[model samples]
Target: MYETKTIKEKIKLFFIIFFPILITQVSLNLMTFFDTVMSGQAGAIDLAGVAIGSSLWVPVFTGINGILLAITPIISQLLGARSYDSLAKKVQQAIYLSMILAIIIIILGGLFINPILNMMNLESEVRFISKYYLISLGLGIIPLFIFNTLRCFMDALGQTRVSMIIILIALPINIILNYLFIFGKFGFPELGGIGAGIATSLTYWLTSILAILIIHKMKPFKEYQVFSAWVKPKTKHWKEQLKIGIPIGFAIFFETSIFAAITLLMSEYNTNTIAAHQAAMSFSSLLYMIPLSVGMALTITVGYEVGAKRLNDAKAYGYIGISGGIFIALLNGMILFLFNDYVASLYNSDPDVIALTVQFISFAIVYQLADAFGAPIQGALRGYKDVNMTLIIALVSYWGIGLPTGWLLANFTSLEPFGYWVGIIVGLSTGAGALLVRLRYVQKKYDKQQNPSVD
Candidate 1:
């Protein structure tokens, strides 16, 4: 599906895959957005409970599921190489791995939920709500992991629209369920924030079931016979995927945890300052989906070319994807700069919060610019299965440099909360530079291997 010969065709193909992935990303984010909004309607306490629960859940979920993300590049390369014989088994093994990971999360989550909550000086009701919310969310972990694994499979096969359609179908169901459970509609109990958690869990199961049904009936995927013959778990396959996946999982963990860390650090500030920071973060995260989708699309295209032994084609895809991402970032920056006030107003009516939010968003323009550069390059590197270096880069950039710098500035200097954002921007820029250098080196290494006579 990714055999584009010209730049125009490559761009066309990239975007076709990209737009659907973008929609999927946005839809997923909207689910979380709606979760918070609906819970807020229940009461401020309910909203706070859900927010606290999510702050812990989001990083863990993304990090663990990131291991399953390896499935995309692996499957894409198999398709490009036309290595069909082993595809189903590889997928099957990934399913097993996901199941194992999901169970571990459920167990660990149950054990640690109370102790973690205890450490935080939360009100009794909020603590109760937070504990139950996480427990309710835990019910869906298995299916969620399975759904993510299937999503990787679909994305790898160039059927991003299928996943997009599935999420679109599920999004409304989630909202409706949230309404029913949160407000006790249709004789349901008024469980408030806990209801949102239940709604999300149900939504996850629905999505996973839909994915299974689609693969069962779908044409190209049906031909693969992924579910027909379940293979026993093989340690070798687990190792192979883990070798590529562990670094990816930790890299994503480090990146996401940095944001969580920033949120925690912001707790010391006044309510207006904290709220403003969150508002800006919410909007900025929405904008991030654009470049993140582009990066994901690049992973598919680049992996396909590399698997096909078309090193030059892969290099071209990396260039086109990164450059296109940056151009889009420029547009995003302009939007943020031009409409900062208007955007801030959407989040709050208080003039203090609005003013602070606008300022925080100004910092986000630089953050987005740097992310536009870094995120896609990381995706491209994954295409080459060059993940270990990305993990190392993430560690040094985010924790070693980013968080420390933010801490120093926020604590010791006048930048205050804004200092954390500056730290994020610097870390992202540094990572982007490192990723660019690494991408160049990997491309050259592949090119040299392909044509040994070259200097």
Candidate 2:
């Protein structure tokens, strides 16, 4: 009985899903941007500390929670298939899995992060502040994952506005808290870079708690009956979730971890070097949220089509999403390339930092092109329930090709951080090329399977 939508209608629907997710992503990255700016105001050392701390934990955060992210695609497909009866149970299983992951993160990452910092050979002051920053941020790991689980659930159902609004509300609070705690305002102890950690942690708890309350009370969520029953952790659910999620997690880890490793390597240079890297990386990351949101939308759209047994429609959505991503990426890259210096100045007033930032942003601009192609295709693949291949491809691209090239160039040549940036470009291009080819193969294969009489 459902009427088919025209291409224009589909595109509009994509943006409706995309913009809220984009807002949420922009808000999330802005939190980090604000943190870096606040710490930079404190001093070069503070900025470096926060940067290094971020470099260490961002990967861990992404990798661990990345698994839970699979819930979005899984649920989206189920919804498309009209398999409403099991939605609540599946959501419960994801929450239970998230809790287990959180505990492990706290025990391993929180308790034993110091040894890893020690091995990095950071300056004593930088090491001291980074340690506390990571630990303070670690305190909110549970709430963070809980928030992610719920957000993914809502987003898959095309209800992204709530999370966007919640994060928007939290952003200013985090900035205010950063100012108060970092500068010893309102009789609070001045914690500098560590203050950013506390501020972000508090924001995480607040947002997660709000999400839970809203989900429980919202009229829309009432149909899902997420809270109607308590289902104990089941082995089959655990295995299935893990089977889908672990590859997704590692894929994220491979991409993020290489960048983290580069940051660690840059520590040998100086605080100024690390500060500049943070500025450029943060800005680039902000731009990346565009394609990322587009890709996420693709995952939902494609998965829904696949589940609804609309294979041809899924192929069309995949191509439409990829084309949109590339166009936006090129636009973003041009802007960054054109205004790199002006943008860098906004992060810090330090001349050396700004100069370095300009250079790094140039590469970031180029990097966006590859990111555009790769990110959306990966999202499309997720919709197809094809993730293990992504993991394999990521490993080959990032570790096999990217890291070794960066290490050799940075250590033995004059490129330094630039060398690492070059590696990123190479790795992203490799992955993008391979993914696009793979997606074409998948689409054709699926089409063939769906229509045996097709030429």
- Kindly list the per-residue Cα lDDT of model 1 for residues 356-399, writing each as its tens digit: 98999999999999899888998899899999999999999999
**Candidate 2, 394: how far from true, in Å?**
0.2
Model 1 CA lDDT for position 222: 92
| List of clashing residue pairs for candidate 1 | none
Q: Give the least accurate 10-residue stretch of model 2, judged by summed lDDT.
A: 1-10
- Estimate the overall C-alpha local distance difference test score of candidate 2: 0.87
Clashes of each: 0, 0
The lowest-lDDT stretch of 10 consecutive residues in candidate 1 is 266-275
Which residue pairs in model 2 clash with each other? none
lDDT (Cα, tens digit) per residue for candidate 2, span 53-170: 9988888888887799899888988988999899899998999999889999889985678888998868899998899988889888899999999999888888888889999999
